[model samples]
Target: MGRMSDEPARWTRATVYPDMWVDPADDPRDGASPDGELATLLDFLSGYRMTLRMKCEGLDAEQLARRSVPPSTMSLLGLLRHLAEAERDWFNWISDDDPLPKLYGERDGDFDGAVGEQAAVDAAYADLEREQAATDAALAEHPDLGERLRKDGIAVRELMVHRIEEYARHCGHADLLRECIDGRVGQ
Candidate 1:
């Protein structure tokens, strides 16, 4: 059973993913090397992605599909599915220029995979894991983080800082969405 609603609030705040939360990396002032900013960013992204996954850990199929906020079709499961597509879109299509077609049926239904049942949820997560792995491997293949990618004739870093930004932004969304779902917040 869940905690009694009538119980006095013993805790000042709830965390979105208490068990999954990680302390920030050592500050740059600790005499550590100033290099590896890309690596640091990537680590942060990986942590946040795991946090997003952890936030949905115990929810069932229906609970995962439940819209935590009103007037919004976004669900925790939907965010997961969307982020997965987003990862592929940026890394596979934009960064590595893979000619592979998109997943999740049609273009508009990327997030729709989050709906239906537990099987759908599992599949979405699996897709995300696979895509993330491939992307990571691709990133590893390129040692030059400063390599410029010609995107529409504009140069972009191959280090994936933009993808890190994307994950951070969406993780913020996930934090709020999870909070609305069960009053969970923090981290």
Candidate 2:
């Protein structure tokens, strides 16, 4: 009474309908070449960034900044700003340069200040892109993931893995938030 060897893996993403945000063929992240660890990690990171943007797509400033979840100031706009701040922090940690002052002055300024304003929304997107690019540039300097960064010698691989984890967790939160906002689901 053993399972069939030819059967697919236990974990599958099968769905009744094409409920995903994008069609399989249209998914930019599909068919990503497994070039290497660095390449794979970077690709996944980029895909997650794209996913976050997609989740926020077609939404107005108010929608983007709405704290849909009660008792939690967690909004899509706040996540975007917080991500930018987090991305900037990692870049500083990797370089040990501490180049820019923190994005938001207060401890939770990133989220707390995510007001429902078009200007804030635009700035968040811009900041996220700018910080991501800066981090990518700094990351290119170290090809060896095993290499330790200057600040406290945190390995490059650890940092990359952490970035992926952070994005994935937030993306899950986003799925819920977006569903609550407009009933749209699937990634």
Pick the TM-score winner.
2
lDDT, candidate 1, 109-155, per-residue tens: 66555685978888888989988887777667665666554454322
Give all candidates' CA lDDT scores. Answer: 0.65, 0.84
For model 1, name the residue pairs that clash.
Answer: none
In model 1, which runs have C-alpha deviations exceeding 4 angstroms? 1-35, 94-98, 150-159
Estimate candidate 2's alpha-carbon lDDT, on a 0 to 1 scale. Answer: 0.84
lDDT by residue for model 2 (1-187), tens: 9667532232213243446766676677788478899999988898888889888988898989888656888999999999999999989897765577899788889888989889999999999999999988998999899999885899999999999999989999898778777767756
Prediction RMSDs, each to the true structure: 5.7, 9.0
Off by over 4 Å in 2: 1-16
- How many residue-pair clashes does candidate 2 contain? 0
